[model samples]
Target chain A: MKQIVFQHHPGNVSSIVRGILNRLVIISFLFGSLASISFAQAENEVLSIKSPWIREAPPGIPTLAAYMEITNITESPISIIGVSSSIAKMTELHEVKLENEVMKMRKMADITLNSGQTLELKAGGSHVMLMGVQESFKQGAEIEIIFELKDLPAVKVMVPVKKDS
Target chain B: MNSILLKTLTIILGLIALGFGFWLAINQQRNTGPLISEEVGIVYPQAREIGDFQLVDFDGQPIDQQRFKDKWWLVYFGFTFCPDACPMALNDMKKIKVLFDEKIAQQVDFAFISVDPARDTPDRLKQYVQYFDPDFLAATGEMSDLQELATRVGVVFVVPENPENQNYVVDHSTFMLLWNPQVNLQAIFKAPHKPEDVVKGVKKIIAAF
Candidate 1:
């Protein structure tokens, strides 16, 4: 009996060692892929939005507005074609300019933000105009606005609805 | 001969400009007061009279100059579709209202008159103005009436020619007119209205009156 056990021990031990080595290789590969994915995400975080907020409007109102401070940390300039949100039927870049004592609302096709610059979307100035709002945006409700860049990935910003103070 | 005529014309134009500058300086001095502390707004030498306009209030009641009788009014012309300037100006007016004491608040009222009457119905105006403050008043009327009232108050607005173009914007004055209790135009508060300036202006005008 001792002679038989010694003869099979070498084969059994080698098989078990091979199985453990295979699992180690697979785990390292998985960790490598995850690290690269996180690195890519860190690289893509060049556009940052701060203090995003939506101005709550009354029920049955046709249009509402959103304001934010958008900063571009990249070395290249970016052009924002437009904005879209699920809460509105349509979205537009609207500018309220006081030209010669006349307040005029004009549709802006695109907004260009230079590299390392910030654009302030504020009330009584350039703002994101959501038209044909489908639902009422009460105070403290959260909404999502998607900004379409000219050639880059869309930036999604979650904004909270707030009443003007 | 042409050169001599040109020189004479230039001298006459220069004299006219100088005279105009002199008149403006004197007018500025006359209008200055504690109420008109900063040069951010315009205080007319004399309060101007506005022409009569027939309109319907947010409650569907007929409103004219008579409806706004015996109370100071800070009137702004904007439509409900206005996404920026109207809301901002109204917010400023709201802040100004909050800054005033009860006595002054009682003597003052806020009005938002819509130039885009084609879309700003009584119901819409009611929702729009009352959104800012329940006490806020709003009205809309025929384009002719709006135009006449705007001109009398030294403001103007132009809407789209086609009534079907619902997406069109109405280009209107950003100035807020200060009306005396008698319903006459008292002063003009320019755009980018600061609440402190507006409050000071209103107090001064009321105290002077």
Candidate 2:
């Protein structure tokens, strides 16, 4: 009887151990699925650049304007501090402003990129002012512009120089 | 008697040739005068003189009548947001610059004054001007002041109501004002003015001064 009782006790202990192992496996599986979902959500919030282009400068002129659209997918705000191009001696962020009655243009320190927002840098508005051009910007030519973003890896974009429409 | 007759005929022939030469010279003189005079057409009304006003350039520098003195200024008034006409006009101005002789260009100046000062700050004006010609200067000031100057130059500028509604457009005159060294508004050329006309007008005006 004692031998049979000991065997039953050992069986119960084994069953309890097996039950805890099963519960742990289920908990681990749930955690893995939740982690993947969070990662997918984070990946979907990447910012994108669009419609990047540059204006053709007149002959012998060393300055030009570059325009683009910045689309933010994140739920937080971002900002563009500046840009650089190998083809230009200097690149700056600029905005067209109206002081009093005159239309004026000046360099901007930074451009805000709001969450899930799109900002356009177009002619006669905000634009990237490229100065001291190293080479002539021919029509239909593709040039590379590297945009520096706040707290993110810089984005390299190819912008076409086109005739003013 | 035969010798005397021959001599008289020769004399008559000489007189006829001389008379023809005289007539040709008189006609040439009359025609040449008008040709030269017509070359100097009446100065366009808007180009007559520069009005007194204070404005700031793209660099936030103050520009007034004094800025135009001692240099030949080619001034045009337009906004940055103009899609077609303004850019076309500026391109023509650029062509005019290319057409100018290098020595003459050194003494010449170009500017684009903003008619829509409400949106065109000095900084925005600068970028637009620089895009066309790096050497070009842009200026803007109070709307009332610009209106006053535009009125004097016969330019029409009307700001649309509700400009903040995102579809606002400004209607303004399209004229290029040419000022001479004496700071006088020497002449005004209407829009769609040819680059050749600008070159010719500028050369003539510069030659006169």
Candidate 3:
């Protein structure tokens, strides 16, 4: 039995090792496929908003500016048609134009976003203006702002009140 | 190179630290603050001296360049209705106050001049300024008075083109003008202003004067 085993061994042993390696490769490939599926789930979600913060000021401030970096991840473009917040009676899309030493805050009817583009609503620039705010937006407070996009469901974003440094 | 050499180096380092600590102690006792910001603009050789104009302060007292004299003044022009820029500037000034000692704080003054006299009444101005700091003074008067002071001070402001619009906007300069005790527009600290820079600028200005 030992002589027979030795005589039949070399090719079989090599093929067995090859088979184990192939099994391991197949297992890893299966996991890779699962990861790609999860990635696709994230890819399907188009609009990604980050660092949403409400610019806080002293108390009894009537208007609060909410800033965020908005990215449209999908192939299609997105535009912001309307904005609303429970804390304010009115919300408007506004942009600040600095020229001739004047910082001009102008209201916009609608703001558009291009595909694969990022919009930064930053301080001293564009912002979502919340006027007649009922709630105090002092530092460390969280406020919800609902952005109604064209042809999309209103996405609610929780913005933290970031005090001026 | 050897333990003896290492001991010498350590002792030298100890002496340097002791010297630094002594210098800091002397500085504290003398109340001589260091200038921190490098960007304090000294543009006052041809300083646009603010022309004569009288505006009613929040206390309903008349304020000309004469009133803000004999002390350092930091003036910014904006309205109470402003959302972002105005409040941010005022907050910056408040932080500038926190950078000084009590004696220097008394010497430094933050003034907000309103372009919209129609809206910012003494009562409204008082409420707006004291909301940031009780010591801050808010002033507004006739449009001509505001324009004359703004022009000579090299600050320009204009109302939004549409007169029919009730919710109008006033486009105003955001520079925080620093005035010496002589009330000459000594420096122009342009926005976006930082608390530390403003503090250092004020200290350097005071020290140099």
Candidate 4:
């Protein structure tokens, strides 16, 4: 009778250990999925920069403009606070408007992008002013243009220096 | 001795024949080289003289009214910072020069004067103007001085209301001013300018003169 009772007591301990192992596996699976869901959201692969280029001018010309298209793939809108480039002495957001039958340019502080909207910066319209170009931007060379956002980390875009078609 | 005298007479007769042939070529061109031009550029009823003004050349040399005398001047007022309009205009000016005869080409002077002197420097102008043509001249100087030249050239330029913004784009006219030997403004070629139109317009204007 003593041997039988010892086996019965061991059975209780084995059951408790098995229950703890099962709970741990369930906890691990839940945590893994939760981490992956947040990681995918944080990556924000929906936003993209496309076809960035600087307008070409004569070698000694000191100023030129850069153009690009920004696309917001996410369902929410993106807000742009500022832009910068190391290639130029300074950079400013500008827009060209027809005023009194003549084209005029003005500086813009910030821009807001709507959901699923692609903003185009082009000639005779919006552009990035690159002032005091020290180095000649060769036709095939690449330059980095950084966009400062309101919420996310700054993104650096590599734009090609090309002539206007 | 008789053979020597005959040779001298033959040489004199040959020289006279050559002179007569040259005279005939010159007379033929008067009738053949010129045709009555149907369409001419808008000519000012009175060619207004470009009054006394002070500005610097690409070399930073001071330019007075008298510096432009004794030549046909084609002056364009624009900034080097301009991407499309300015380069296209200057390039067309170069093409037009190529179409002219060497004598006619030598008589014309091409100049690019910047209204945006705050940003355009003489050193930059010196290098920038040559990109279009080696013979072209570029200049920029004090605002009042530039205005004196601009007004005489019939170009209008306006700066930004806020001068603190160093990156301001200037609003200026794009037409090229054509002037005569006396520094008088004669005609204006409006932009979206074509090289052929300029060449034809200049030829017609010269023929009228």
Best by lDDT: 1
The models' CA-based lDDT, in order, is: 0.84, 0.73, 0.79, 0.76
Pairs that collide in candidate 4 are none
**Which 10-residue window in model 3 chain A sums to the lowest lDDT?**
A1-10
Clashes per model (N, Cα, C within 3 A): 0, 27, 0, 0
TM-score of 3: 0.72
Chain B alone, model 3: TM-score?
A: 0.77
Residues B147-194 of candidate 4 have per-residue lDDT tens digits of 777877677788766665565578777777788888889788776566
Q: What TM-score does each model's chain B reach against the true chain B?
A: 0.81, 0.78, 0.77, 0.77
RMSD of each: 11.3, 16.0, 14.0, 13.4
Shift of residue A35 alpha carbon in model 3, Å: 19
Clashing pairs in 1: none
Candidate 2 DockQ, CA atoms: 0.03
Q: Which lDDT tens digits does candidate 2 get at residues B1-209? A: 99999999999999999999999999998644421123323364334665588888899887788888899888888777654346767888889999999877887899898877776777777777887889888898888888888877666777875654432446666667777777777766665557887787777667655
Top-down DockQ ranking: 1, 3, 4, 2
TM-score to true structure, per model: 0.84, 0.50, 0.72, 0.64
User: Candidate 2 or 3, higher DockQ?
Assistant: 3
Q: How would you order the candidates by lDDT, starting with the best? A: 1, 3, 4, 2
Please report the candidate that would top DockQ against the real structure. 1
Tell me the tens digit of each residue's lDDT in model 2 across A99-151: 43334455687777788888788765777777667577788999888877788
